[model samples]
Target chain A: MKKSVILSILSVFLITIFLGGCGSKDQTTLNVYNWGDYIDSSVIKQFEKETGIKVNYDTFATNEEMYVKINKGNASYDIAIPSDYMIEKMIKEGLVEKIDFNNIPNYQYIEDRFKNLEFDPTNEYSVPYMWGTLGILYNKKMVDEPVDSWDILWNPKYEKQILMLDSQRDSLAVALKKLNYSMNSTNDAELEAAKNALIEQRPLVLAYVGDEVKDKMIGEEAALAVVWGGDAVTMHRENPDLEYVIPKEGTNLFVDSIVIPSTAKHKAEAEKFIDFLCRTDIAFKNTDYIGYSTPHMEARKQLDPELANSPIAYPEPEDLENAEIFIDLGTYIEQYNRVWTEIKSH
Target chain B: MNKKWISAPYLVWMVIFIVVPLFLVGFYGITVRTDTGFVFSLEPLQRCFEPTYLKVLGRSVLLAAISTVICLILGYPIAMILTSKDFSDKNIYLMLFVIPMWMNFLLRTYAWLTLLEKNGLINVLLQKIGLNPIHILYTNQAVVLGMVYNFLPFMVLPIYSVLKKLDSSLIEAAQDLGANGFQTFIKVIFPLSIPGVVSGITMVFMPAVTTFVISRLLGGGHYYLIGNLIEEQFLSVGNWHFGSALSIFLMIIILISIFITSHYETDKEGSVGLW
Candidate 1:
C-alpha cells in the first residue's frame, strides 16, 4: 500500500512537469520588457485577445538593468522601453533593430515635436512612448517659503526632511542645475562643483530614494523630494497637499521610447504590439493610467480637459526653454560614477 | 542502484551552477578587456582596497556582526526554553518561529516599510497613547532589526537540535557533584553546545554580510554597504570587473570567518573533553 501511494505521488509530479512544458507551443509569443508599473494590465490582455498572440511581459527597475541584460546577449526580448539616452547608446552599439515604419502606420499620430530628437536623429530606431521633465516634488504643508529653486533643498531648516533621487544621473543633474551649469556638463571644474555640492547637501538628506519616493512623499515622511513629473502626478492624486515645481535653475527633460532589440524572435508581432499601443484610444488609456505625458497627438485630445491642459503634464514651450534632454555621455559616464561613489561613500 | 551513480545528477548540477560560476567570477576579477584582448590585470582587485570601497566593506562587516550578536543573544535563550524539561507544547512554539520564514523574505521586509512608516501602524498606536511617534524606519537600527529578525531562526534551530540530543545524565551528574544551576550550565551545557553556536553564527553572519535588500529597504539607501556597492557596480555603473573583484573579496572574508569559527569550535571541544 505504501509503495502504491509513493508511486501515485511520483506520477502526479511527473504529470505536472510534463504539462508545464506544453504551454501554448504553437502560438506566437511576444516578449516585452518595460519599466516597472509603466503599463496597465488590461492593455496586455486586450492586445493578446485582439491579436491572438501570447504575451510574456517583464519589468525592469532601471534602464541600465535592461541594457545590461540585452547587451550580454542573454535574453531574447522582442520589445523594450528605454529612456532616450539609453536608446541612443543602444543604437550606437547596434543593439537595437530599426523599425520598418511600414508596420507601424499609427506612427503618424505622434507629435512632430518629439520626432528627429538627438537620440534617433532620423527617427529610424525608436518610437516615442512617454516624455516628462524632472523637478522638485514638495509638500506645501511642510514648507512655509516659496519653492521655486533647487536651493531650497539645501536649507538647514528642512534638514532630515528632504529626499533625493538615488539615481546617479538625476541626482547629479539637480546639483549641476543648482550650480547654474548644464545638466549634462562633463567639464571637470563644473563636475567637481556638482560633486562637492552633493556632498555638502548629503547631511541634510533623509534618504536617497527611488520609486519609494512617491510613497514617502504621500505619507509625509519627507518635506521635499526630487521626482519625475509622472510620479509627482501620481503622488498628487494620492495626497492633495503635494505640489510639483520645475526649478528656475532648469532640470533634465527626458523621453522614454519603445524599440525592438536586435535579438527579437518576433519582430512582426512586436511591431503589431507597438502600433496597437500608438492607437488613439489605447494610448489615452495608457497615458491616463500610468500618469505620464503622451506624445500621441490624437491621444492628448482624448484625455480629460483639465489633465490635458495641466502645466505639469503638457508644459508650454517657454516653460521648457531651459529644459535639457539627456544625451548619451559615452565614456564620460565613468567620471560621473567616480563622483557618485565619492559622494555616497562620504 | 550504486551509490556513486546516484550522486551523478548532483555532481553535474554542482559543476554547472557552482564550480563554473566561481571560475568565471575569478576570471572576471583578475582580467580586463583591452585593445589587445582580455589581458590579465590586478587593477580591479586592487581597487577593492581603495578607501571608499574599504569603508563600505567595514560598514558591512560591522552591521553584519551586530546583527549576528543580537541573533545569538535572542536565539540561545529561546532554544534553551524550548528544550527545557519543564516546557510543554514545544512543537507549537517551533512552528510559530518557522511560519514567518515560509513567506517571501522580500515581502516580509516590505511589510516592515508599512509598519515603520511615519503614519504607519506603529506610529498610529503610539499617537493613541499620547506618545511622540518615533521615526525608526530607514535607519541603521531598522536595517539591523531586519537582519536579526530574519536570521534568528538560523541561530535557534541548530542550537535546539544539539541541546535536544544532549544526554540528561550529564546534567544529573553535575547536580550530584554539588554544582549549582548556573555552574552546571556554564561548565556542561554551554560548552557542549559550542559546535551548534559556531554553525549558527556562520550561517547568520554570511547571509547578513551579503544582503543588499534589507539594507536598501530599511537603510533607505543612506547606508552604502559592500553589497550595495557591488550591486551598483554591476547594475548601475556597468562595471562587472570591479563587481566580480568585490564579490571575490567578500568570498575570501567569508571563508576566513568560517575557518576561524570551526577552529575555535574544535579547540573548545578538545578543552572540554580534557576537563
Candidate 2:
C-alpha cells in the first residue's frame, strides 16, 4: 500500500514538473538534446539562471537515436547535437533547418579551419561543439615506443591488451583508415577490406567498449583502445602515463554540432541558446568540463595551459590534415551493414 | 480501495500507462507517416528474409535458446532454495540476486566488462590470489553470463511463485507410493510447475533475443545478433525502409512462433498456455 502510494506521489510530482516545463507558447523556452555526459551540467543551469528561459535538456547515447527521435515526432527539441556524419545525413534528408546567421553573431567565435566543412559547408545549419579523432589511448608505462599509428595497434604484441570501440562505424572506420581507405568509403571492396581486417582483429580484441574505455584505460586494466577523443582526454588526465595518438596512417576527425530541427517549435529560443553556448565563457566551461577540444576559437584560449598543450585535445596541425571526416553514405549502407554482419558473425 | 476521487484515478492510470502506450506502439508501428508528410510504406516489412537478414534472425534464436537453457539450469535451483522455506535468509539470497538487476542494466553489463577484461578485477584478483588470469569478458561466455544474470530474476520469480504454491501433500502422496525424491519431483512437482517454467522460458527468451545492449557491450561487436542488425539498419544506415522490413519480419516471426507455441502447449495440456 505504501509502495503504491509512493509511486502515485512520484508520478504526480513528475507530471507536475513535466507540465511546468511545457511553458506558454508565447513564453520563451529552449530545449537542448545532446549525447549523455556531452557537456558541463553547471553551465546549463547557469544559462537558465541568467537567461530566464526555461531549459528542457535530454540526452541520447548515439547519433542515430537523436536522428530518429527528432524526425519521428512532434519534436520537443529546439537544439540538438549530432556528429558530423549525422549532420550531413540530416542536411540531406532535410531534417534540420538552416540557422539564421544574424541571430548567431557568435558564430564568428568558431575556429577558422572548422568554418567550411563537408557536413554544413557554410556554417549555415550547425555550430561545432566538441571535436576529436578516434584513435588508441595507450599507457606509456606499459608499451615501448611512442604509439605512432594504427598498425601498432594491429601488432601481435598488443593482443589481449587492446580495446576496440563497440561501435560499428568507429571500429570499422579505424580498420578502413589503416588500409589507406576513406572512413566514409561506400565502395563494397573497400568495406570488405575493413571487414576482413576486423575479422582478423576481433580474435585479438580485449574488449570493445565506449566511454568506459576511459576508465579501463586509465585504471591500467587495458593497455590501449580505439577510443573517442573526448574519452581519451578524460583517460589522459586520469593517468598522465596514458596518451592518445591518432594513427600515422590517418584516423577519423569528427565533431558534434548543435542544430535546430525542422519540426522545432521554439526556433528563436533555440538560436538564443546556441548563441549563448557559443559565447567564449560558456564554451570554455563546456570544454574544460568535457575535456574534449572545443571548436570555439576564443573559448579555447581560456582552457588550462596543461590541458591546452595536450595533443589528444589538440592534435598537431599535420595530424589534423591527414585525418578523414566521416560523411553520410546513403544507399551503400547495406554493403556496410553486410560487411559488419560478416565481421561480427565470423 | 482508498478514496472516491483518488481510487478512480488508479484505474485511469493503469489504462493510460498500460493501454495507451501499447496502443501508440501498435498504431505508430503500422500506420505512422514519415516526417516529410510521406505515408509510411509497408516497404519496411518487405526485406525480412534477405539471406543476410535471415542470418541475424537465426543468430537471435540461437542466442535466446542458449540463454534460456542456461537460465533454466541456473534459475530452478535458486528458485527452489528460495521457496524451500527451510532456507534461512531467503530474502537476503533473493536480494543478492536481485540487487544487480535493480542497478541499471547497462551499468551491470559494463561492470562485467570491468571484471572480465584482461587486467580487470577478476584477473587481478586471480593473479593476486596466485592463479592465472583468464580472458573472459569479450567471449560468448561473457555475453551469456550477462544475459542470464539480467534475465535470471524473470526466470526465478515465476518459478518461485509456482513452487511456493506447491502442496507438500502432493509430493508426500507420490512418495507414499514408494517413489524416491527424484521420482516424486519428476512426477508431481515438475509437471505442476510446467506453467511457471514455460512462462519463465518465454519471458527470458523473448527479451533476451531483443536485447541489443548486452551483446554489444559484452560481445564486443564480435557478435551480431538480430537486435543489433535492426539497430544498425534503422539508425546507422538511415535505411528506414529496410529497417522497417526487418522489424516487421521479426514481429511476424515472433508472432507466429508465439501463436504456434501457445496453440501446441494449450492443446497438449488441454488448457495451459504460456499466457
Candidate 3:
C-alpha cells in the first residue's frame, strides 16, 4: 500500500513537469548566451520590456564551454557571444548564421575599424561586442618596484603571491610572450620552452584562477594576477590600490562578438535584440557598466573623457605595438593541450 | 509479485539515465570518427598508458588513499565517542558534526579557500598570535585537507550507525573472559565494525579519487590528478573520446578498490586474525 502511494506521487510529479513543458511553447522567447558577468543586466530588462519578447539569458565561463553547448544542439540559443578565434571556427564549422545588416540600422554606430577584422573579415557573421587586452593587475602596496613586464610574475620576491590565468591558451600565451616567442608558436622547441617556463613558475604561483581573480585581487589575497583589461578596470574601481598594465613583452588582444547560431528558432527577435544592444545609448550603458572597450563610435564619444582617455581602457598605439590577436589554431590546438597538460602535471 | 510492478518507474529511470549514458561513454571510448565514417580504434585506450598519464593516475590514488586514511583515523574516534552510552548530549554532538554537511559541498570547499588563503582568516589569526603565516592553499596538503573535510562525515555516519547497533554483550563477554578494555576493542569491537569501516572507506575514497573541483580550487591547477586530467580533456580540449577512455580507466580503479575493501569486510576470520 505504501509502494502504491509512492508510485502515484511520482507519477503526479512527472506529469506536472511534462504538462509544464508543453505549456511554455506559446510565448515567444529569445535565448541569449554570453560569458559570465559580461553584460549590464538592466539592459536585458529594458530590451524585454520594450520588445514584448521574453529574453532567456544564460552564461558560460569559456568559449570552449559555449562551443560544447552549441555542439550538443540540445538547447537552441538564439544569440551567443564568442571570442575571435572561436568565431572563426564557428563560421568554418557552419555553426552560426550571418547577420542581416539591413535589419540592424544601428550597425552604422559600430566603428569602421572594428569591422572587417581577421576573425570575420567580410563583416558577415558577427558584431563586435567588447574588446580588451590580456595584461597584469598588480597591487601597488605589495610590489617594491614598477610592474610593467611579465618578468615580475617570475620574480621570487612575490613568491606564493602571484595568480595566473587558469586558461590553457592565455597562460601558455603569457609564457610564450615572456620568452619572446609568438603567442601562437607551434614549433616544438618553443612550446617546450613555454611549458618549462610555466613549470618553473608553478612553485611561486598561489593559484591558477578564472573569474575568481577579480574577487581575490579585490580582497587582497594575491599581490598580482594576470587578468583581462575589463576585469582589471572593474577591480580597480573596487580597490584603487590595484593597477592594470599591458606588459612590455606584449599580450593577447581579444574581441568577443555577438552572433546567431544557425539553429536559432527566433531569428527575427534575436536580430531585434542585437540591434537594441547596439543602440548608442544602450551600448554606452553596457560599455560604462562592463568597463570594456566599446566598438560603437557614438557610444565611445559619449563616454567621460577621463575614462575614454585612460591608458588602461584606451591605451596609446605604442602600448599595442607587440600585442597580437589570437587566431583559430585548428588541429594544432591538440599540441597546446599536450603542452599545458605537461606543465600542469609537472 | 504484483508489488514488483511498483519498481517499474525506477527501472525505466535507470535504463534511460544510467544504462544509456554508460553505453554512449563505452561507444565513444573505443572508437574514433574519420572523414569517411566511424572506425574502431584502440588509440584512446592506448594513450591512457602513457608514462605522464600513468603518473597522474598514481598521484590521484595516493592522494585519495591519504585522505581516506585521514578520514578513517579522524572519523573512527568520533563515531566511537558518539556511540558510547557513557557520552552525554550524543544527539547534539552528532548534529554538530552534520551541520557542515548540510551546506553545499562546493560552498564548504570554497569556505576553505577563504580560510586557507595566504592573507585569509587563518593567516590573519596566525599574525595576531605573532606567528608567521603559512601558505597552505593551492598545495597537495590543502587538496588532501579539502577531501578529508568534505568526506569525513561520509566516514563517520556509516561507522556511527554500525557502532550504535553493536551488541554490548560481546564486550561484556570479552571482559569476563579476562580481556582488558583495549583488548576487547581490538579483538571484538573493531572486528565487528569491519562492515561499517569498509563502507566508510569506500564512500570517502570514491569521491576523493574522482573529485576535480577540490583539486582545481585547492591544488591551484599546478597539481593535476586523474580527475583534473579527465576534466581538461573533456572541457578545455573538447576531446570527448579520450575523456571517455580516461573515465573508463577511473571506473576500473574504483571497482578494484571496492572489491578489495569488500573482501576484507566479508572475511571475518581473516580480519579478526589481524588483531
Candidate 4:
C-alpha cells in the first residue's frame, strides 16, 4: 500500500510539472500590478476578450510595497501604476522603460495639464492615469466651525474625533503646510517643527488609518479625517453628511501614472494594455467605478455632469495654486522616517 | 518505500523555504551595503538598542507577557474543567474552543473592529441599556484582549492534552494519603503539568510579541510595538537591514525565553510544586 501511494504521488507531481511547463509555451501573458481596487474588473475581461492576451492581475496596498517587489527583481511585472514621486524615483534608478508613445495613440485623450509634470518632466517614462489632492474629509454634523483651513484640525474640541493618515509623507505634509512651510521641506528646523506639531496632535487623533478612513468617516466613527480627494468622494457618496475640502494653506497634489518596468518581458503588450486603459470608454468605466479623478479629458466629459463639475473631484486651478507635488527625497527620507518613528513611539 | 526517501521531499522543502530565508535574514542583519560592496557592520543591530527602539521592544514584551498571563489564568481552568472526570460532554466543549480558530485570523480580528468602534455594536448596546459607552477600542487593553482571545486556544490545547494523559493513579494515591482536592491539585497535578504550561506560554508569548496586525487593528496605531517598528522599516522605509536586524533580535529573545521555559519543563523532580 505504501509503495503504491508513493508511486502515485510521484506520478502526480511529474504530471503537474509537465503541465506547468507546457501551460506558458504559447500564450502571451501580461502581468499588471496596480493599487488594490483601483481598476474595474470588467475592463480586464473586456481587454482579454478583445486582444486574446491573458493578464495576470495583482494588487499592492502602497507605493513602497510595490517598489520593494519590483526592485527585488523577483517577479517580472509588465505594468505598474505608481504615483508621480515613485515614477521619478524609478526613472532615476533606471528601473522604468521609456514608453513608445507611437503605440499609445489614446494618450492624446489625457489632459495637457497632467502632462510635463515635475516627476516625468519630458513625459517619457510614464502616462498619467489619475490625479487628486490630499485634504480633510469632515462630518458636517460633528463640527460647528468653518473647515476651510488646516488650523481646524488642531482644535481641542475635536479631540479623539480626528483620524490622521497612517502614511508618513501625507501626515507630515499636513503639518508642514499648516506651518506655511513647503510640504517637501527637508531643512532640519522646518522638519523639527512639523515633527513637534504632529507629536502634539497625536493625542487628538482617534486613529492613524489608511483605507479604513472612508468606512470610519462614513459611519461617523470619527468627525474628521485626512484623506485623498478620491477617497473623500467615495465617503461622501456613502454619507452625505461628510464634506471634503482642500485646505486653504495647501496640500499634496499627487498623480498616479502607468509605467512599464525595465524588467518586463512583454513591453509591447504592456503598452497595448496602457493604451486600452486610456481609451475613453475604458477610462470612464474605471474612473467612475474607482471614484478617482480621471485625467482623461474625454472620460471626464462622459461622467455625470454633477460629478464632473464637483470641485472635490476636479478642483479649480486657483485652489491648487499653493499645492505642491511631492518629489523624490533621496536619502533625506531618513529624516522623515526618524520623525515619524519618534512621533509614533511617543 | 525507504524511510529516508519518504522524508526527502520534506527535507528539501525545509531547506529551501526555512533555512535559506533565515540565512538571508541573518546575512542582511549583520551587514551594511556601501559604495564598494557589502561589508560586515553592526550598525543595524546597534541601532536596535537605541532608546526609541528599546522602548518599542520593551512594550512588545510587556504586552505579550500580559496576554500570556491572561491566557494562562483563563485557559488553565477551561483545560481543567474539560479534563475533569465529571465532564461528560468534553469533546463538545472542546469543539467550541476550536471552532472560532477555524475561521481566518484576520477576519476574526476585523469582526472585533465592528464590535469595538465608537458607534459600534457594543456602544449601541451600552447606550440602549442606559450605561455610558466605554472607549475600549484603540487602546492597549484592546490589543491585550485581542491577543488573549486569539491565543487562548494555543494555551488550552497543550494543557488539555497533558492533563488527559496524566496518570489517574497519582491522584488516587494523593486522596488515599488524606489529601483534599485543593492539596492534591497544588502538590501533584500542578507540578506534573509544568511541561504543558511551559509549552503553552511559549506558543502564546512568541506569536503575541511578533503580532503586528492585532496591535495595528486594536491599538489604533498609537501603541507602536516592536513588530510595527520592524514592519515599517521593511514595508514603508524599505530598510531591510534594519528590519532583519530587528527580526534577529526578536528571534534571540524568543530563543532565550524558550530556553528558560524548557529548563523548567525538564526539572522532573517536582521542584515546581507549591509548598
Candidate 5:
C-alpha cells in the first residue's frame, strides 16, 4: 500500500512538473482578436516577417463576444475589430484607448469618405478596416424576378429557400428596413412593427444565417438570403450565377474599425499593425482576399475592375443617400435584444 | 459484498465533479455583475421571467417532452427485442446499442444536420424517388429529430438493462393464467419496465431541455432556448451573475422534473426506488 501511494505521489509530481513547464510567458507575443474571416492572414505573416513580434491571432463571431472577452478581464488582446455601434458603446464605457496618429503614417491612405465617421470623430480611437451594407443575395437561376424589394423575402413563393441574417443587429436592421422604419430606431412602436414583420416572416425562413449562407446559397440549398455584402461578394466569387442586390428600401451601412481595448498591453504593436493594414497595397490585398470593400480610395483604384464594378461591393452614391450608420442605443439596447428574443422564441 | 467501497468512491466522485462545480456556480452567481457594472441582484432573475425567456423555457419544455415521449415509444421495443430469448448474441446487440454513443454527440448531431439540410441526402433521395424535395431543416421538426436521435441510445440502455433482468417466469406465469401475448406484455413486461422508462425519461429530458447546440445548428439559431439565454449571459453579454442565475433556474426546473417523475413512479413502483 505504501509503494502504491509513493507511485501515485511520484506520478502526480512528475505530471505537475512537466505541465507547469509548458506555461511559458513571453512579452514579445502580441495577441490580436478580430472578427472571424475578417482579415487576410497573409498580411499578418508579412507583418511578422517585417517586425519580429510573434502575432497570435484569434477570432470572435460578434462584437459582443470580443467585448465579453475584454470586459470580463481574462484575455489580454492587443487589437480588436468591432463595428461602429460597438465602437460607440465601447467609447462611452471608456473601454477603448485613444490612437496616436504619429505611429501610423499610412493612415493617410484611408479615404476621406470613411474618415471622421460618427463612431470615431477625427478618427481618434478607431481606424476603419472595411465597410459594407446588409442586403439580399439571390440565385439568378431560381429567382427570375427583378427582386428589388425586401418584401420578396417575405413572399410565400420562396418559403423554404429563404435565408435571413442571424446577427441581432443585422437581422433586426433588415426587419426594421422592411417596415420602412429607421435602422437605429429606439422607439417602441417602430420596434414592435419590426418584431411583427419578423414573426410573419419566421414561417417562411429557411434559416437565420451568418457566413454559412454564402456556401449554402451558392450550392442552391437556399435560393434567397439576407447576407452581408462581404459574404455576398465571397459567394459570387465562386459562382457567377449568384447575384447580390440591395433592397429598394435602405439598409444599415456598417464600418468595422480596429481599436485598442483598455486591457491591451501591446498598444504600440497594435497601432503599428493597424498602420500596416492601412497601406494601400495591404488594404487592397485584404479586400481582394476577404471580399469586403476597402474603405481606402487608393485601394479602390488598385482593386480588380470586376470587383470595383460590382454594385454589391460599391453601391452608387444615389443608392447610398438613404443608408444610415448604426448608433449606440444605450439603455434601449436591452429592449431591442428583448424584442429580438421575443420574436425568435415565439 | 462491500457497500463502503462503493459509497466511498461514489461520494468522492460526486464531491469532485458535481458538488464542487455547484458551489462555484453559487459563488459566481452572486459575485458576477451585469453589463451596466451593477453587482448581483434580483434584476437578472426578473429579466429571466420576462416573456422572452419564458417563451424560450416553454419551447424547451415542449421540445424535450415530445422527444422523451418519442424516444421511449421507439426505444422500448428495440430494448425488449435485444433482451428477448430469441436474440442469442445479447453482448453483440448491447455493444451495437452502446457503440453509437461512443461517437462525439456533436458529430452525431451534425450527421443529422447533413441528413436534414436542404440538398442533403434526404432531399436528394426524395427527388430521386419522384417526390418533391421537402424543406426539412431549420424547423421545429428538425430540432425534435436531432433530440430523438441523440437521446435514443440513452433511452435504450436503461430499458435494456431492466428488461434483461426481468424474470422469465413472470411472463410465462401470465401466459399460463390464460392471458395472450399482448395481455402478458401489458400486465407483466410493460409494468415491470416503468423503472427503466422513468430513468430513461430523466436522462434524456434534462439534457434536451438545456441543449442549445443541436437547436442552433439544426433549427437555424432563431429558436432561442433557456440554454441560449445562459450562453448569451455568460459568454456573449459577460453577465456571469445572470448566467449563473439562469443555470440555477435550469437546475430548479430539472429538480422539479425529477420530483414529478419520481411521484409518477412512486404510485406505481411502491417500494422499488429507481436506482
Candidate 6:
C-alpha cells in the first residue's frame, strides 16, 4: 500500500510540474465585464499574449445588468465598461474604484475634450472608451419622404415599419426630444407628455429592439430603426442602401467609459489592461473594428480620412448645438421606471 | 438491502436546489429593505394587485388558454390519426412530428419571425401568388401561433400514448351496443383518455402562460405579459423584492392549475397522480 501511494504521489507531482511549466505559475488572470459586442476580441487575445495574463471576459446587455451584478457583490470582476450616467451612479453608490493615472501613461493620448466630462468631472474614476449619438437609420428604398425629424417615427404611414430602441432611457429620450423637451427633463408634465407620445407611437412601432436592431436592419426587416451612431455606421457598411441622420429635434449624446469595480480581484492587472487599451495603436485598432468614434487624439489621426471627415463621426459644433448628455437621475430614476412600465402596460 | 440510503443524494439535491431557493424567494417576497435591516412588508405583494398588473395577468391567462384550447382542437385529431389501426409506419409519423422540436426552441421561434416579416419568405411567396401579404408578425395572433407551434407536440404526445394503450374491447363493445362512430368515441375513447387530456392541458398551459420570449420577440415587446413583467422587474428595474413577489404569484397560479387538474384526475381514478 505504501509503495502504491508513493507511485501515485509521484505521478501527481510530475503532472503538476508539467502543467505549471505550460502556464507559468506567476501569471495573473483578469476578469473584464463590458457591454455585449462592444470590443474587438482580437485585442483581448493580444493583451493576453503580451502580458501572459489570462482574461475571463463577460458581457452585459444593459447598464442595469452590470449595475445589479456589481451591487450584489456576489461576483468579483476586475474591470467594467458603463455609459456616462451609469458611471456616475456607480461612483455615487461606491461600486467602482478610483483609477491611478500614474500607471496608465497612455492616458496622455486621450483628447482634452474627453478629459473632464460630467460623468467624471475630476477624472478620478473612469476613462472614456467610445462616444456616440442616437440617430435614425433609414433604408433609402423604403422611406419616400425626408427623414429629418423624430415625428416621422410616429407617422401612421410607416405603421409596423418603425423599430424603436428597447432601452428605457434611450426610448424615453426619443419621445422627449420629439416633444421639444429636454432629454433629461424631470418635470412631471414633460415626462407625462413624453409617456403619452410613446403610447401614441406604440401601435405604429414594428418592434422595440436591442442589439438585434443591427441584424434586422441588415436583413431589411424594417424601413427605419432608432439606433446608435456606432450601430448605424456598422449597419450602413453592410447595406449601402441605409442612411443615418440625427433628427432636427436633436438626440442624446452618450459616452461609455471603462472603470474598475470595487470587487476587482486583480486591481494591478486591471490597471495594466486599461493602460494597454489606451495605447494609440490599440485605441485606433479598436475604434476601427468597432466603428465607434474614438476620443484618442493620436487614434483619430490614424482612422480612415473619409470616416474622420464625415459629419457623423466628427459633427460640426453648431450641428450638435442642441445635443444633451444624460446625467445621473438618482431617486428620480424610479419615476422614469414607473412611466416606462405604465407605457408598456398600456 | 435497504434502498433508502441510495436516495440520500437525490434528497440532498432537492433540498439544496429546490427547497432553499423557494424559501429564499418567499423571504424576499415578504420583506423590504430598511435603514437598519430588512423588515416584513406586504407592499410588494399588494402592488401585484394593481390594475396594470391585473391586466397583464388577465392577458397572460387569456392568451395561454386560447393557445391551449387551439392545441387541443388541432392535436386531438392528429393524435387520433396517428393511433388509428389503418395508419402505417406509426413510428415514422411520430418522428416527423417531433423532429422540429429537436432543434433549439429559440431558433424555431426566431425562424417564425423571419418567415412572417413584411419582406420575409411567406410575404414574398404571397406576392408571387397574387395574394395580399398579411400583417402577422407582431400581433397577438403571431404570439399564439408561436405558442401553438412550439407546444403542439406536448399536447399530441400525451394524448397519443394514452390512445395507443386504449382497449379495443371497449370500443367494440360500444359498437355492439348500437353505438355509431361518434357515439362510440364520445362514450368510450374520450372518457378513457381524460388522464392524457388533463396532463396535456397542464403541460401546454404551464409553458404558454409563462412564456416571455415568444411575446417579446413575436409580439414586438408592445404587449406585456406577466412573464415579461417578472423579467423586467429582475433584469431591467433591479427590483428583487417585487420580482420575488411576482414569482410567488406565478407559482401560486401554477399550483392552482395543478390542483384543479389533479382533483378531476383523482375523481376518475382514485389513486392516480398528475404527471
Best by lDDT: 4
* Alpha-carbon runs more than 4 Å astray in model 3: A1-24, B273-275
What is candidate 3's lDDT per residue for A81-135, written digit by digit as tens?
9999999999999999999999999999887878999999998999999998999
Per-residue lDDT over B1-275 for candidate 4, one digit per residue giving the tens place of the 0 to 100 score: 69999999999999999999999999999999899988999999999999989999999999999999999999999999999999999999999889999997977888898899989999999999999999988989999999999999999999999999999999999999999999899889998888789989999999999999999988888989989998888877888899999999999999999987887788777455322
* lDDT values, one for every candidate: 0.89, 0.78, 0.89, 0.91, 0.83, 0.88
lDDT of 6 by residue, A212-317 (tens): 7887899988999999898787887899999998998988888999999999989999999999999998999899888888898899899999877767767777
Clashing pairs in 4: none
lDDT, candidate 5, A219-313, per-residue tens: 88888998889888899888888988888788889999999988888888988888988988899899999898888888989888988878889
Candidate 5 reaches a DockQ of: 0.57
Clashes in model 2: which pairs? B44-B244, B44-B245, B45-B245
RMSD of each: 5.6, 5.6, 5.3, 5.7, 7.0, 7.1
Fnat for every candidate: 0.64, 0.51, 0.74, 0.77, 0.68, 0.72
Error of 3 at A192 (Å): 1.9
What clash pairs does model 1 have? none
Residue pairs whose backbone atoms clash in candidate 3: none
Per-model TM-score on C-alpha atoms: 0.95, 0.84, 0.95, 0.95, 0.86, 0.93
Chain A vs native chain A, TM-score per candidate: 0.93, 0.90, 0.92, 0.92, 0.91, 0.92
Query: Candidate 4's error at A255, in angstroms?
Result: 0.8
In order, the interface RMSDs are 1.3, 2.7, 1.3, 1.0, 1.5, 1.1
lDDT of 2 at A319: 81
Enumerate residue pairs that collide in model 5: none
**Poorest 10 consecutive residues by lDDT, candidate 4 chain A:** A1-10
Q: Please list the residue runs of candidate 2 whose C-alpha ends up more than 4 Å from where it truly belongs after superposition.
A: A1-27, B1-46, B85-104, B251-275
**lDDT tens digits, residue span B1-275, model 1:** 69999999999999999999999999999999898878899999999999988998999999999999999999999999999988889989999999999997877888898899888999999999999999888889999999999999999999999999999999999999999999998899999898899889999999999999898888888888889999988887788889999999999999999987888788974645532
Candidate 6 chain A least-lDDT 10 residues: A1-10
lDDT of 2 at A33: 82
